[model samples]
Target: MEQSQIQNHNLEKKRRRVLNKPLRLRCSVQNYNWGILGNKSHVARLFSLNSGSHIDPDESYAELWIGTHESGPSFVDDQFDCLNSLKEWISKNPDVLGDQVLKKWGGELPFLFKVLSIKKALSIQAHPDKELARALHKSQPSLYKDDNHKPELALALTEFEALCGFISLKNWLGGADAEQWLPVNEMDKNHELEAVLESIFSQILLSSKDKICQSLSKLKWRLNLEKKKRQLTDKEKLVLRLEGQYPADAGVIAAFLLNYVKLNRGEALCIGANEPHAYIYGECIECMATSDNVVRAGLTSKHRDIQTLLSMLKRRQGFPEILQGLSLNQYTTRYLPPFEEFEVDRCILPEAASVVFPSVPGPSLLLFISGNGTIGASVPEEQMVEEGDILFLPAYMEFTITSESKELHLYRAGVNSSFFQAY
Candidate 1:
């Protein structure tokens, strides 16, 4: 068979398999361990919109997952259609998985996408790298859970704040109150980051309860004193906030060791494996490699794996880069991260504009953030989507989105060759 004939035959097979249309998948909600309490969260509102009902007033809203990762695989209908079933169908019709993704990931959707609503601070935590993840899962299945590495991208939907990575060495050691850290100042500059961090963190965690209380009181007094004189640094403000929320818990001091990051709407931060972080407030869309293993340090009532967490720290310290979307065209901004597991694009359509996306080589998950829109491969075949709605686009499926309101906002998540080209 000639190349053109092979291509035409493949196209026919794909049309029969996927029909060039988007499928409205029912995403599942997760309350998880740490999340904003009550119905005040945007997550709750979004959930209500998607399910066509109100969320319980007392239940905390956390995450709405739109993938097939076993933890919270999305369904296709009331029959509880699973993504695994979709995978099975794609296996027989390889064109629906596309040659690139099928060849690389064995037809698996390699990312987990989420919308997070945080009303309070999450635990101080870090995710293990791929190799560490596998070993930990094998040794401690209950705690480690999965064997995949989780390198995540957090894009702010509303004003957001988080503790990400470590502060620069100069800032960590040369601050005005540098003397307070004692041995941190005394340690050799040539020591390994693991040794340096382990030494300091161990001291903080091992401090007596009375010492912790005393330190907390002293920090409050100094902050109040500084308030009368000058503005507090970002780190100072974060320390004060954590102390207020956690009282004398050692995590209050841990906050000082990490960089405090504040992201305005549309800004983002890519969290690499072994980087310590915590979401402080507001809502964001997060994407990660399909893993749930986390080693937490503090600031919560949950179990703290101090030794494991300390061991996992990257040891290399620096500020994390905040990302801005690269405009793909007039209607979309692609927020490309350095990792390959996933990339997100924000599509902003004006009142009457319509955008056509040609068939992509990998599957995509779309989430409706605001406004109303109609999605279809052909005008006659479409579905109406409003806030909180989710659609799964199989590979080789071309579709168009038309805004039905004054403005329509949505996010698209997928993985591609771009993932391997960058960090």
Candidate 2:
């Protein structure tokens, strides 16, 4: 081989060495607040936790992270000590991440993949956009670590409930006295929706505990009395549930003002920067830009950053439009969002049928949500994957997935290209 040809040959060998096989990943589970209590969580079951597993019966299983986000980076196969060192390992192998990602994001992973199991509602929160995130991180590095935006997309694993964005409070406001319910200040009486919302939140935060309790008690009595006259709506039931979980919580009161959404299995909801939302309950497969920075308003024992949250929120009216995945074929459906950082797709490989995934600009994280199957690359190497298993595929590495069981369902998360191009 000539000099350039010899160099190309060596590069081809390195690519084959690294990208020819799928690397089974061991992800880290996060036992955070607001998670489902006990091992009854789908996350726990998916991870195969039994009576012998060293898990507290009362501990909440919050999230199972399957990416290189530093908080809970998944490990490469057989690299037990590299549990949180996958990002560092990828730094050494730039080819695995591909040139586009390396050029755009350096050695860092651009997205974070998660399996979230929420029992109690999460805080009423919104993440900052890229510009704001950069400023926030610059000013408060202790709270916001990364200078990147966090736009999230979540697909339901179970019947999922959430409070997302503002709905027109006009109808609700007309029936009741906004002044009595929200205790808005005089200056905010004629303010825009944004300022009015801020005032309402501020009042809720500043009100005496006894006053909040009294208000909640009256509201509960009214709902009960109304129920006797007629059937309660879904929104009313949601309010009751929120009250049951966190009585007199500002978030419960705030929840009454937001859009209530229910996502069935395979349905998705996208929340962009500054779109306030609270995951109420259920299991979900969530993907987001690589950041954990959240500004919260209420509904938790965690730190409440009301000022920061108010500043970051969009302060608009109406529920967000839920995203529906468009099928590429019988087996594959792509969930294309507007953001450039990440795209997610679902594949259901049927028994005796297979689907080939072509190359992409960046590496991919494949999560086996259910069923059993075998996956192989161009090189003929194959491995079995079952429920809860995760595999990392290097950039430009083509692969085929086939089902040995009845069907195998998998979700793939990667940096967007073609799908985004059309959108």
Candidate 3:
């Protein structure tokens, strides 16, 4: 055979090998100590698989990381090397590494997976849009901004409560009654708070510290009085106090804030960037595009950037009615966002349900949070995966999962539609 033909044959063979190699995704779980704020012990334990004395019964077991970003790169083997380090491997052996993955995805994986167990509410926060993130990162390269839009989905591992997006201004403001005697009642009918608080939020934007202080003052008074009298119910008092501290927080205005959502075992919530939100309680399997640039406004004592966060906030008022918006298959419920870089889905397989593989061609990560199941992928035939086990399926690979005990609950993370189209 001619030299060119021989080289082409060699290239094709190498491509097969690289594509066939399975990437072992990384898992991170944080644990929380009693009364300790910002305690990510569950995340730490899940990522490290450390079962120390601090492990709580309510803590999350694992958070799977499948992307090539540097925050927490997935391991390719037990050796524990980052997937980003594989760039040299790809560059040196381009023939083995598919040209498409290299050219479009830049030799890096695209999505990140996580499972968060929270005993308390996460900070009310928002993420920057792509342009803002890029600009921020450019100005402060040392900071964590990476110019990626992080649209995330969280599936409840247990009963979970989260403040997602904005409640309709009408619903929020309408709930505020003049006779209610709340601080908000002090405002005149013609005040911006009264008008903008009830309509679509786009009509006005909160621009001054005075406006924020005024709203906050009202919330504080109500909360303090409620605490002293103990007249409000337990849930009511918690939110009332939170609202009092951060009255400008749109999440506090959500009706969901007043009520707790009991996600039995398989329910989920999807949150997009700049949509004001907060995770109130319960354990959840979370998945998102590989970025961690958060601009927190309030709700927790973490970092607060009221101005920057408010600027990034998508102030359009209306509670997202997403309970029934997802696309549901027999065993899976897919959360599809407007962006295509990431998609999160919940798969609840019955004991007798056929364990099928995902159809997506890009990298995929499966975190088995519950049930005794057999997973077939890079391993021989079928390996038993338990509640804490996490499995990684590389591109174009197939796998089967069968539950041997009770129903198996799993979260699957994969590249969104945009990744494939772009490639």
| Index of the highest-TM-score prediction | 2
The TM-score, computed over Cα atoms with residue i paired to residue i, of candidate 1 is 0.87
The models' CA-based lDDT, in order, is 0.78, 0.79, 0.57
Q: Write candidate 2's Cα lDDT for 254-321 as tens digits.
A: 77777889999888999999988999999998999999888877887777778777777786777687
Per-residue lDDT tens digits for candidate 3, residues 150-203, read: 777777766777666654445544553222432233334456643444332221
User: Relative to the unseen true structure, what is the C-alpha lDDT of residue 173 in candidate 2, on a scale of 0 to 100?
Assistant: 71
Query: 21, model 1: CA deviation in Å?
Result: 1.8
How much is 19 displaced in model 3, in angstroms?
Answer: 4.9
Instruction: For residue 318, give model 3's deviation from the true position in Å.
Output: 1.6
Q: Which regions of candidate 3 deviate over 4 angstroms?
A: 1-21, 29-66, 79-103, 176-195, 198-235, 240-264, 323-329, 378-380, 417-423
Query: In model 1, which residue pairs have backbone atoms overlapping below 3 Å?
Result: 340-419
State the lDDT of candidate 1 residue by residue for 1-423, as single tens digits. Answer: 999999989867755644356766666678854566657777777777776766877788899877777777776642322344444444555565566777777867788889998877888889999998999999999888889999999999999999987666677667854536332445545677545655676677667779878877877887789889998877787788887778878888877777788899999999989988999988999998888888887888888888888877876677788998898889988887778778898898988799987666788889999899888773366788888888778776778899999999999998844843433
Query: Which rank order by TM-score, best down to worst?
Result: 2, 1, 3
Indicate the residue-level lDDT of 335 in model 2. Answer: 86
TM-score for each candidate, following the candidate numbering: 0.87, 0.88, 0.72
